[model samples]
Target chain A: MGLIDNINKLFDHRIRLGIMSILMVNDDVDFNRLKELLDVTDGNLASHTKTLENAEYIKVEKAFIGKKPNTKYFITPLGKQAFKKHIDALEDLIRNPK
Target chain B: MGLIDNINKLFDHRIRLGIMSILMVNDDVDFNRLKELLDVTDGNLASHTKTLENAEYIKVEKAFIGKKPNTKYFITPLGKQAFKKHIDALEDLIRNPK
Candidate 1:
């Protein structure tokens, strides 16, 4: 195998990658904003978000915003570490090709 | 939404991403080399390689080496451009936090 072989399979999807990419920069991202940013359907976003949630790579918060339900996502420490390691693996493969 | 909307869905899988990363630096890669480098099952590698081939992102070559069957892969110009754009989008997202 290459220098780094293990790449987290969780962020292998485009939607999940989009979610992580956005969350890496923003501390808190609302459901609507994530949907908008990823340009994914409500179902699509929810399904992928659920996967990340199950993996505990992200945390979700639900609250009432002036009588309206609102949900937001934040990357956890574990999530950040995993994401960074995944990126490092990619970079390593890019730099060294066997 | 981020500056780049499309991130090339073809590379959303870890195996496919690995294939592209390795092919980016090396001009030609044999099937056994990829199989060993990625450490993927024979079926897994073939399936994913077929996907990339269908997308026209990679080209495959079949030959005989000393009476042994062999196969190789190379990235096309379109694939190189797509991979570069995909990486650029990732770096852009990393640099800019919306």
Candidate 2:
């Protein structure tokens, strides 16, 4: 009940939801790969990533790829828990609508 | 590829996604009941319902329940098709991350 409200607010945006969904299944997602998969602009992906990162739902890893820097993202334990909860809330809403 | 992008844009909002999910399983849902289930305000639900209605994903039915007006929603055939496609697209994004 209350959990559903939280779930709705947290995953209200599609880009954010997509980011979580991608990070949930993959071991670690690269910045470029997310942009490609989500097909969002660089600015769009960066802003959304920042939101998730600020929430501590994801941790960013940076490395040097030759001369260029590569960024990768990994879901934290907390992120996994929250994302799972959100999914479960959605399922509950679908299965048992009051 | 392109499909994922379209899917992202279409189901980007949680409320819209929620509406589709609820209607998917139930034959018809009342407006007030939806407000109760989603735990959203009247204005909030109305705006979201308008969006989904504009998308033609759900059809609205109006009837009088004892002198009171009752508005119920049912997913149209097209709506069902789109919802299924959107889900398949999400599954594709999750299962085969390419």
Candidate 3:
């Protein structure tokens, strides 16, 4: 639902983009799981996830897997396209560096 | 000197990474020009530039072009490599997005 903005810079911010890129590769990553992998704080993870959710780059689902609650995340189609455009832009940059 | 990091999301920040990528292709760019092109504020651009400068991803030179002062920015060798790695990471993301 969004056009390809120069997402290199938009999604290139380490934390936010990391969340999206990882989610794209993994079917579903839980909050604590990503937090451990990225070594980011809980608040940091939550805030970045909120921003991605607002941008519709990812979808978040909350459920229970036994007694404990679980949160799962997935990259959206729009996000995949955006990531593709960003990669294309990067490739262009690599081939045309001054 | 630095190794390739997962830059897919690192340089993707619109302001910071745009600054680097534009500088790469254009040789150098002025602060005001970038501010106008990116439609960012003075403070926002300044802060973001500081972050890049701190990361050693760019070099800023302050000089005078007549009576007024001018600031010029260029991507360093380290910065260029970092940008390359980031692009590579983005490409990886694009090729294998889930």
Candidate 4:
């Protein structure tokens, strides 16, 4: 496939891209940590995470830590594969530059 | 600046990204060539080019080649710099994966 064809539309948004980038190296990330790392508001982070979740790219886990709600996210196998393809396509675009 | 901050919002779209990618290496590209390369409709290409033009990232030239109108695009210096930065940030994101 063409490099452009490998660029996934799901990661078009910067927030989503950031989420995936963080998840790629980290085992799991929490909601507040994501918000802090991405420097986005709670609502903004929530909505973007929801989009990733809906696409099954990232799975969310909600639990309680000493009665405080803790929400964390993990990149699914499909997410890692898709993100790797997207990054590879981007690198190819830079290197090939047609 | 953070790697994410280096990612330009203007290049978030695949079409726009493709346009810049082509312009980065080629001296100049005509409208039809860009349309063919990006595989986008005339209207879609026009709108995305307009956005880049509005940002002053690209310059448009209009002429007639034997009575047939031709539109061509060239990337500005500012555009080249910004695109380079964006590409560098993407590479950093892949390499560092923070």
Question: Which of candidates 2 and 3 is the stronger one according to DockQ?
Answer: 2
Please, what is the whole-model Cα lDDT of each candidate in the order they appear? 0.84, 0.79, 0.72, 0.87
Best by DockQ: 1
DockQ metric for all predictions: 0.56, 0.40, 0.30, 0.55
Give the chain B TM-score achieved by candidate 2.
Answer: 0.90
**Greater-lDDT candidate between 1 and 2:** 1
TM-score winner between candidates 1 and 4: 4
Report how far residue B65 has shifted in candidate 4, in Å: 0.8
Candidate order by lDDT, highest to lowest? 4, 1, 2, 3
CAPRI class assigned to model 3:
acceptable
Off by over 4 Å in 4: A1-3, B1-3
Tens digits of per-residue lDDT, candidate 3, A19-85, equal 7667777888998887876678889889988988888888999999998999988889987787768
Residues A61-80 of candidate 2 have per-residue lDDT tens digits of 99989999999999999998
For candidate 2, lDDT tens digit of each residue in B5-49? 646455667777777888998899999888887778889888988
Model 2 error, position A83 (Å):
1.4
DockQ of 2: 0.40
Better of 2 and 4 by TM-score: 4
TM-score of chain B of each: 0.93, 0.90, 0.87, 0.95
Evaluated at residue A48, the lDDT of candidate 1 is: 91
- Provide the TM-score of chain A alone for each candidate, in the order shown: 0.93, 0.91, 0.85, 0.95
